[model samples]
Target: MFDLRMWFRALQIIPRLSKDEWDRLDLVSRWLIATRAAVFVMTIVSAGIGGILAARDGHFSGLNFLACLIGLVFAHATNNLVNDLTDHLQGVDEGNYFRAQYGPQPLEHGLMSVRDVLRYTAITGAIALAAGVWLVAATGTAALGLMLAGVVFVLFYTWPLKHIGLGEPTVLLVWGPLMVGGTYLCTAGQWSWDAALIGTAYALGPTAVLFGKHTDKLPADRAKGIFTLPVLLGEPLARRCVTVMLVLQLLAVVTLVWRGALGWPLLVVLAALPLLRDTAAVFARPRPETCPPGFPKHIWPTYLVAYAFRYNRRFGLLFLLGLLIDLALR
Candidate 1:
């Protein structure tokens, strides 16, 4: 019998499945857990921002919108699979690496074999590429170019990009101008600097989440000779950087309102101020080695990233809601 409960849990949290439980999971559930589907909401938000912005601009296609969302989500899932596979092959995820401690690293944790994970990656990547191809055919050369750029990021991100302290910045670019702007191009069939700019505002949320994850893993990364941004900047400075990004996200929204690109409804994102404030407070301090009180016990070994993810979900939803209202009013 398909375990609907496990399926839902996998969608919401990276469930730590035992060997038998892992075996019992259906293929869809297995893929969901392997791809870290819980975080796929970020990509969905980025796609929604792009599609909604395109609609507001009076150039929206339902086909294009669906293609963009599916393509981005599959691309993100492929990236997650690649990250785990690369780290596993490189031995980066060995010896209880921070990644495996927080969530299932399929290959490293023996939840999946090399062949199994590679099959998953190939299938997911092919679907994303197919969607991109359909989108390019529909939109023309511009969409083709955008698809190529996304492929470059997807292929190289975990290996050289993350290793060279470009991972965090990569997230910003990919989630913001690349995914969102690309969605606009695919759906609107034209470019919009305004769409790109607004997308960047939402982009900061995922960027902050990556910064938090990297910061949380700084020590382990350092010991393993991994040079993530946090390992490069040191934990204290990196945490401060996250705070700066959060502030910039807010500032970006205000600037857009002032420029008349968005309406007062967009200011509703300010409703997320409390969550942002709490996230900033957490980022201001070093991650505790032990589980802090009131922290979710199941999410242990994940500190800053957990808090950042919470803030990102809240802010993203509010931003999307504001954009919807803005669209309705316009």
Candidate 2:
């Protein structure tokens, strides 16, 4: 049965592909797992906001909104695939699974062919782009523009700009706040400052981890002629930078509260017990490796999940709690 086989495959991935060379299934499985999580998260955020706005305004458009959410998920998954292809083409990931690893490692192990991945990425991208077009068709210019920008940033994250060391900022702007904020706006119609701020906070925490993880490999990254912030700015400065980013995230909570963008209960951000663990990890460099995997593996995803806790248990939960309070009091 497919279920049995799927179960076996999932179990095998933990140990087998974790250390073994890349395989087609290895790449496909990782891609699917992340994509599924993303689609699930984004769908929940978009849908919850859409539902709430509908309840309040009495002008809720369900089908159009649902279609738009689907499109957002499609667009996001394709973006991840595109990142994979660009990284594969760039020599940033030189087939050595051990040296530079994050996201999908099968690429470096020669487990899957570049041509196959690129072809699949293109197919998935086309689906996502078409979905974006559908959103544009339904909502007009703003949706179209945001969708186009999202697509471009996703593809370019690992392209020419990445070669110049813009990876962290790009991820921060696009992956962090941009995607979450843009998705909220697409559904709610008109800009909500709460949506934007929450999206930014939603994005900022993860970016800290992602940036920290990337910085951990500054030495290897620099030798490869890549230009992440750590390589350009030096390790000590980058470490300080991580501290600053975390402070900025904390500050965002206060700003949200002041603006009525977040409610008092939004203090639940403290529930990020895992993030505290990450902070400890960030301050202490990883042993087997010089830098910590705290951010990429533990931190970035943790922020996103925590952000999802208050509402529908998807993405943007923390922000939604803020939004709920905003709606209730007003």
Q: What would the TM-scores of all predictions be?
A: 0.98, 0.73
For model 1, which pairs clash? none
Q: lDDT (0-100) at residue 243 of candidate 2?
A: 60
Which candidate wins on TM-score? 1
Candidate 2 residue 285 Cα shift, in angstroms, is 5.1
**Candidate 1 Cα outliers beyond 4 Å, as residue runs:** none
C-alpha RMSD values across all candidates? 0.9, 5.7
- Top candidate by lDDT: 1
Compared with the true structure, the alpha-carbon lDDT of candidate 1 equals 0.91
lDDT tens readout by residue for model 2, 231-286:
79887677666666666766777777677656675665545546554553544443
Full-model lDDT, candidate 2: 0.55
Worst window of 10 by summed lDDT in candidate 1? 1-10
Number of colliding residue pairs in each model: 0, 4
lDDT tens digits, residues 83-175, model 1?
Answer: 898988899999998999987888877889999999999999999999999998888888887899889899899989999999988999999
